[model samples]
Target: MQPETIKTQQPDLTGAAPAARLHQVAAFAGLSADQTAHLAQPSNIERSIADHMIENMVTTLAIPVGVATGLLVDGQEVMVPLAIEETSIVSFVTDSARKCRPAGGITTSMSGTVMIAQIQLVHVPDPYRTRTLILERRDEIGALCDACDPTLLRMGGGFRDIEVRIIDTAAGPMVVLHLLIDTRDAMGANTVNTMAEAVAPRLKEWTGAQPLLRILSNLADRRLARAHATWRPADIGGEAVRDAIVLAYRFADADPYRATTNNKGIMNGISAVVLATGNDTRAVEAGAHAYAARSGRYRSLSQWEVDAEGNLCGSIELPMAVGLVGGATRTHPTARVLLAITGAKTAEGLARIIAAVGLVQNFGALHALTTDGIQKGHMARHASNVAIDAGAVGEDVAQVAQEMIARRSINVETAKAILAERQSQRAD
Candidate 1:
């Protein structure tokens, strides 16, 4: 599962046939011929390995894996795999990544791989006294949490600290206990949940209060990853475009409605990478949205600014609770290969790369939004899908799409008209 140990020379999938690309990546990763074929066939019987990974004995659900090229992160060229069903995301991020590559690519910073477990204590009589008692018993609570998993200890990660918070609500005053654990290369849901359960009885014992909701917090504020990129104004169509992008950011910054969509644009890139790398998208999304409103107002996750030299600068900081170990990240054929292709050395590196992708994606979106428009390039890119939808197969797909474009109308109705005429001419 350590992609850093991939000693074989990497494969360049440029111009490879789509149908054959899966096996090509498998071979590049030094898998056996059987594993290579397994990558292509979801019904290979090998993928649905019964009862171990999941339930109901169903087959694997597959999504088209598209690569966003030209990303130079941390001085290393990376091909990011996106598992999203949306159009223009891969193209947009790729566009920005290429534009900023000459200016030293992207620099990133990540906080610790710590996850939080919450022990909710209800019906506390003396809240202040209970808080003091809980703080004094920090070692006992931390020791009980650390004992929940032996393997987590072997990985050089274990319980770190405990925090107590007293909240007053309509129901009454309640004391909350927070357990911080370094789960190390794991998404840490199960690990932190186990610790919370293990320490729950003691938590109830010490405070003479009811312990409920022993679980990990999805608002992973502690495990944050950040990325920044700078692009010269001339390189990105001069000062007007730069200021326009900043204005585009201002619109989002000022309005919650615009900010949600703006942040969704960034998550379009982050979520795809998360899905591709086999992380929990729902948890990541929850944390991201919660982190967005941490300042009491929802706003964009990224900021656009002009540097002293008039170069456009963009930065993004968000919760990235991704991991390299366990779950589908290690077992899923495509996910494992994507990690290798990404060439990230650690979980932090993986997180940094994802954050950088988000920043670049936002840049492309704003750049397009402030200039021509989003749909001009996006619709043109996806017109072939519309052509296919209109029942234009094979040779006629491109033909119908081209005609639709020529007519300046790229939709189902337009595509169908082009196909019908083309078919009539063929019959004639």
Candidate 2:
């Protein structure tokens, strides 16, 4: 017997009502009624908004948002909202910040909100000669770029300078032009990209080369943010712990494997705030990792040392290409609220806060590593999740989690056993 072929039309969800779009997607994807109904529940973001935010939107995944308290940056106490699923980060960062408060908390500085746009020219007739020609036309190129964004220019931000470099690649030699622009209050991807595109034709004509890959560079070295904080030996468990932390940092600075995890711990705090504020986490991560490897070797993004007062001092510097005026920062309601809570009046202010948070977060991880080990506190917090996963609810969840922690056995099986023992005792 021959089977009949079934022709199904692909669902056109463009401009369709949210409910209609959901139904069509559900039907096309062969979702069960229960699964479809489960996804139909009220999300933190409205379906209408989510649909417009991205393509092929089926549902919104909500992450728990919590705030770290008592983070003092540049003499101001600010509460930072962190949207992440990982446990113990908020508490650890809060504790680290409190420990630093006795020594004046975290002080931060920014290297301006400058971003770079790169124009790659290949097959140039004479690469070095083209570079010289580009330098001679710096004023013209700057004016051309400045003209791309009138609002930016009026707001005291536009083209600042131009740089030309000649490099050899596997393909051949190439001439690269770097357009430095002050992005003002924006991350400036779009602004700089437009400038690069607008100036590419002129660059190609001058160099007699083909222009390719005119875009913004994620290695935002020009937009660097730095932070430093001191912790008294008495405040951070005395000289022994402080010295151990410095040693740990030395290990990370010497090895790529350790540096990767050390950098990730820093980003755990920075990325959470970036996501909560609706900024680009990937861009920040890329820039940070690239900056770490800028010295021809991968190393820690932060430094730790012992100061003259026998206190532990920590500092961090990284490329922070985050913005306040565009993208999801303006469109997401929750992001606006988070920004208000942060009290950052400009992009530079926000970057400073993020850098400070990264420094403190790294300190917290080092403190944990040198003292009680990272998993001790981490597992204690994770016990609650295991309890919930083992079918404990409400107050029972806390009871089961506590029992598991007390027993030094944090797992689903332990949680279930604890719950079972409780039920049996209640019946008796």
Candidate 3:
């Protein structure tokens, strides 16, 4: 006899209710009824909004949102909401901010909110001549680009300048047009991309060059955010600790291996706020890393040194391509609340806040690394997670975690053993 064949039906989830969609997905995946209901539990974001935010939407994944206090940016005391899963980041930032508060907190400034859009013109008969031709038609090109977004122009932002360059590539020599645009209070990816597309055809018509890859460049060199802070030796564990931080920064500045991790530490703070505000975290991260490597050698995004007062000073500069409008910023309810909490009225203001947070976060990491080490504090904070993972419940969770930390052995195995001991004692 032939073997029995079974076929599973794929449910049509289009236009289905959120609960029904969950049930269908669970059934298809052979999940139990309890599992299906668990997946349908209400979250901060409504199902309809999650469905519209992206295609083929399932349930929303929730990340813990914590606030870091004592951050004084530009002479304003601000509490920043960070959406992240990592342990100790919020606590470390808060501690770092407290240490720097006596030194006037963090002073920040932004270069501008300018974003670059690149239009690659290939197969040009005369690359240099084509570049000049495009530059000469600046007025016409600006008019076309500005026409794409009249609202941006009305808001005191739009086409600012135009640049053309001819460079040799593996394929051949190509002329690239850089459209410098001030996006104002927005991240401007969409604005600049639309402008590039709007003006690409005109360039092709004028120079008989093929227009390819018209898009916004994430490098965002024109949109730089900077921050600086000083920590007195008395505040940061004396001169020895301060000098050690400078040496640690030197390692990152000299070696690419160290730089990658060092930059990641900065992003831990920047990306958390970016996610909390519904900004483009990936864009900000890409711009930051690219800016770090602009000198051909990847180096630390932040600098640390001893100031004239024998205090440790830290500064960070990176491209902050974030926006206060558009995308999920206005749509997501939690993001709107988080943005309001930061008290940033403009894109530049938000960029400055993020830069300050990055600098302080870098300082916190260096302080921990140069002192008792990172794992001590990090693992201590993570102990509760290990306790829960080991099946400790309610009050037992904290007890087990505390015991693990006291013993300096934070692991799931140890957590389980401790929980077992507590249960045995209770039974006795």
Candidate 4:
């Protein structure tokens, strides 16, 4: 087995390098000498497959990974690593998480980590009868599934059960089979997809229908994550601030146009952590949006309400289908570092942390929207990007950004003029 690397994560070892931090954390946790040594090695991820993992060996895409600290989930403190280019998300969420530290932080839960695989069969003569036949032979079908991945079966992860549905479409009726799998540590896409295809020949024979489109469904409603948090009125500005946040949520719930933007803000935080963990951001994104519109109306995935004690209560529920093993999570070295930083040992723990982070993020965002507005804190950070774009370097970048925010003229042109003036002064 490859050696493990423990990052230094102590109160005093804040700015230490990765190796140093790992040792500190190991010592702090009272790890054995051999275990600590095993965890202190550097990460190595080479070409695992033939161009499937990294095709053409192009340059890597870069996203700034920032630590959102002071978040307490289930009574344990965790630092979330967020990878994104958006402004103000990490800062505000970090602030809210810090303030929420004393209030027991965030509480989270999850349904079973189950994923769906759809087997589409068209041209069925008796769709209902076909459904019955498919359900009756679930054990036999499951056996075929387990045969494809003996290792997964041995690991106690395999096809859990099967479901058959007969739906009437424009042309005719189609028999859709839903295969549910307990994926355990992995996402189980390939495992379940393989299971679906293994039963295709039998499904075709049993129903006398054509089997097509056997794949995993991104609408992972079966696997859900939820988080709940409460912020006192005095803690979050005042009672008016809490009520205003509820009003903002009402606005999103009333219209799809606003709801899209609202949930996008929520994902602005969720997707960053999702990417940092090396999970499928696209799949999570698809599941989130689909779940948002699951009520036949595209609405916010979060809810804000005023409590009797006048504290602001925030809760969010979404289809959070992430994994600790398989795909990029297993293949990427940086992903390993970030996951370690988050201290999520299992897929379920990671899901809970992600959901909690998203909730705190939404909480911070709505407070800003209801009070000082999104542009102030958001644009202040945008100023730095504008300065960089205008060719400002080092100290000049900070000066130019400060000037842009002060003058309320944050644009590429303003940054360039200020940079030129600073250079002229230096020359003189």
Tell me how candidate 3 scores on lDDT: 0.88
CA RMSD of each candidate after superposition: 4.2, 14.2, 14.0, 5.7
On TM-score, the stronger of 2 and 3 is 3
81-148 per-residue lDDT for model 1 (tens digits)? 78888888988887898788767678899998999999999889999999998999999988898788
TM-score of each predicted structure versus truth: 0.92, 0.89, 0.90, 0.89
Which ranges of candidate 1 are over 4 A from the true structure? Answer: 1-16, 19-36, 42-47, 50-60
Candidate 3 lDDT tens digits, 384-424: 99999999998898899999999989999999899999999
Model 4: lDDT to the true structure:
0.83
How far off is residue 383 in model 1, in Å?
A: 0.7
Ten residues in sequence with the least summed lDDT for candidate 3: 1-10
List the lowest-lDDT window of 10 residues for candidate 2. 1-10
- Clashing pairs in model 1, backbone N/Cα/C closer than 3 A: none
lDDT rank order: 3, 2, 1, 4
| Model 2 Cα lDDT, one tens digit per residue, 1-428 | 11112111344444576577557655644556664565455554678887888899998788876567667788776767788999988877788987888788889999989999999999886898899988999999999999999999999999999998889999889999999999999999999999999999998787688899999999999999999999999989989999999999999999999999999999999999999899999999999999999999999999999999798999999999999988989877667666766778899999999998899989999999999999999999899899999999988998999999899999998899999999999999
Better of 2 and 4 by lDDT: 2
Q: Count the backbone clashes (under 3 Å) in each candidate.
A: 0, 0, 0, 8
Candidate 3 ranges with C-alpha deviation above 4 Å:
1-42
lDDT-wise, the better of 3 and 4 is 3
